[model samples]
Target chain A: MKRFFILSSLLLLFLAGCSVQHKVVPAGNDVPSQKYKMEVVFPKGEISGIMAFKRAGGNMYGTAVNEFGVKVFDFVLTGGKRCKLKNVTGFLNKWYIRRTISKDLPELLNMDFAEDALEYVNYRQNIKYKLILIKE
Target chain B: MKQATIIISFLLLSILPVKAQTDNEIIANIEKASKEMTSLQCSFTQKKQVSIIDEVITSSGVLYYLRDTKLCWEYKKPYSYKFIMNGDKVMLKSGNTVNVFDTKSNKMFSQISKLIISGVDGSGISDKTRFDVSFATKGKDVVVTLVPKTKDIKKMFSEVLLHFDVQGYFIKEIEMIEPSGDKTDIILTDRIINKSIDEKVFHIE
Candidate 1:
């Protein structure tokens, strides 16, 4: 009976530590939207309905929403706009660890920093998207 | 003599109605739709889908539609490629290379133009003349499916679907299924209608 009580108390302590506490701070830009939409046509075919999120900070993230409904943007922009982008999470689908999309692949491969450097990842297709800060 | 007459009769029966469609109905729809198209100067958003390496690659650009058949589409990000269509000539400018295509000689260009004109005008692609038209409503939107009844058109595209809102005649999307079993979906969003569109905005130079 003493052993059972101790195990039960330990399990409760472990479960308490694993409880999820989430705080979502809204992230947005300071400037108002002065953006428009455009389409890109490639030599092979056409890519339409691109959202040019322009004049977005001194630096802007140009978002192109594809027909398949994937949204992709770069971390750099304009002449001086760039992203101080730190890799947060890479395509988190539940508990599975997918691919990494950071330009710093060498950093990600390191044991100390690999998981922190992954951003957007697709496991089935192995497609990774990374954002780089381009100085304008 | 009787055998030859029977064969010719069968051929005539097959070709007559199909021939009548392209002449009377298809052209009429095209003309009507073109007339109602926005003569206005407004920049709109376009979404295009292309399948590459088991995934679709997307890009964005600004489309300036000017007078006549002249429109300049400028790609602003990811890659810089411009499609400038002026009257009968279509010029493509990308990177350091530029190529001009005579739309009259290009069947694909003509088909694309026809599709766009039909879409902008909201004339039913499922018209009895060009397609066997039918509809299925999804929530508030009506999906009009156009199946090519004619042999020639069927050889190009098997079916085309156009979506329209319940209240307005606004065309929201177009889905074209080619004979090769591939599909293309074009969605037009945030369209500004009847604004004062400039004539020179369509010129390439």
Candidate 2:
């Protein structure tokens, strides 16, 4: 009875450890190209704009504009890995802004991560930024 | 009577010198007229063309300028956005969000805004250090072409053209051609000049 009790405890511990380990899932690559109205909430302030994206030959090209119809930025993502920022307005031409947007784009566009459709809310550095995709 | 005759002769001689400089007469008159302009409010329609993609985008907005420093561009249709520049500070508002920053940190924006303000007022075109200016006449319009001399400006735009109405000396259209063959044309209409503009309109809270 003593041996059996020890064996049972060891099995429980092993099972618990296995259950705590997380499984990593790769994002889906089948998301269709579409236009989305993006709103970014930062620590200083928030900005809303329209983004038009097109995927061709496994590459993504995008252009964004402010509500005043001013062109903000144009970028290209090749093979889902390499990123090239073609043009950007002076106010948003910072390194951190570019890095943050690049990191969050895939997740926001539903190209990465398995999640619900149409809306995504992400938190970074205690600031919450949300992206809502509207179908035209 | 002799002293009065001498004074009249002196005035006529001064006027003759000015008249002899006919090449610069139009620009001088424009500069003189712009000095009296305190504020201006106008509506503008802008059309941008991207040659690579073969796409043309059109937008309309209202523009406000107050003498030297303050300017505002507000868009109402399709969506609402505001860009206000007051001295060294710039503010942009879209929807409920407002982003404010100092223009000193952004040299490119500062330079561009300054050029726009000067261009609208029709005074900076004579700055030979910045642009090579040449004038031409096209029917009732006086067309002025400015080719950028600065490297930073030349990298973005090849040339800028301003069209003025000869009778009123009012700017009617502005065209900017980019190095990449893209062009942006802005047409200003319904202009009201030298109007009293409330100072509160320049501030963005």
Candidate 3:
């Protein structure tokens, strides 16, 4: 019984170390306009884009454009919980891409992640992506 | 009857050679002009129409190209982004970060970039192996339609049309039609050819 208990404790510790902890904070009424260089590395290939985030009237707005100035996605985050995609490219209009963008945008722009944080790294199975906020 | 048939065949054969000669002459003239160009700078206005969404996106940018494979496409309005292709390397800069990739590693990007470079210098119309080229006239503008022969390009674009002014012998506009009926038209203006371009313009850093 003691051996089984020690093994279970070790398993729990291992899982805890792998998990990311995020602290939720209250939504702000306005967030300053900020620009970021967003890079997404997927299984098939990698795509990089410029993202501009702005907040006005308690709603968050974001626009992402590729190197060719082609619009990839434009979305709005309302009340910090619900995400509304205003316009998206044909290939990225699917549910999975929308879900990923909706989740990532808040983490990159929200007050919950802290303004001083310059880098956010995310990993899902074999796919990994990093967002580096550019200071101008 | 035999005499009439022979005459008809001769006329048809003669007309075929005349059409081919016209195409060759046009391509030769474009090539000769391209050879004299050392560098090119121009401002372009791009309009992308997405038929599915019924949306038209307008953007304006500057394009710089150097002979022997170097190009910098910088978009300034709406959003700022730069794509610099130097030889086999491509650098993309957005905001303050830069990403570098080798052309060999990304086949699709390499192909698209090649198309853009060739289109700017009028070499794409001469590449008969990759594309089927035909010429037409719309009013005063000379239009060259290029249909990709390869499956890879056909998947992305249905056809590309290059419009030139017969007087200037330079490209004035380029239009790419996609398989989904989406079209992107780029109008080039304020062109400076064979001008001295600073080498620093090609560097992303």
- Per-candidate DockQ values are 0.02, 0.03, 0.04
TM-score for each of the candidates: 0.44, 0.65, 0.65
B17: Cα error in model 2, Å: 15
For candidate 1 chain A, the 10 contiguous residues with the lowest summed lDDT are A85-94
Model 1 regions more than 4 Å off: A1-136, B1-37, B40-53, B66-68, B124-129, B149-156
Task: Calculate candidate 3's fnat.
Answer: 0.03
Model 2 chain B poorest 10 in a row by lDDT: B49-58
Clashing pairs for predicted structure model 2, backbone only = none
Ranking by TM-score: 2, 3, 1
Write one digit per residue (lDDT tens) for candidate 3, span B1-205. 9999999999999999998887777777777777777889999998766332233556678999999789999887555778899999998876786778899987666877978877888888888898999987788777889999987677667898998777666788989886645577889999999889999999855
TM-score of chain B of each: 0.64, 0.86, 0.90
lDDT by residue (A30-127, candidate 1, tens digit) is 33322223332323444333333333334433333432223322222333422322111122212222122223222322223223222344344454
Candidate 1's docking class is incorrect
List lDDT for all candidates, in order.
0.48, 0.70, 0.72
lDDT of 3 at A134: 56
Q: Candidate 2 on B1-205: residue-level lDDT in tens?
A: 9999999999999997765575387787677767877889999987766432334556678999998889997876445678899989988887797878788976655766766786788876777998998887789987889899988777657888888888877788888876645677888999999988888878967
Model 2, span A64-134: residue lDDT tens: 65443345666666678766665665467699888766666665554542422344455654344454454
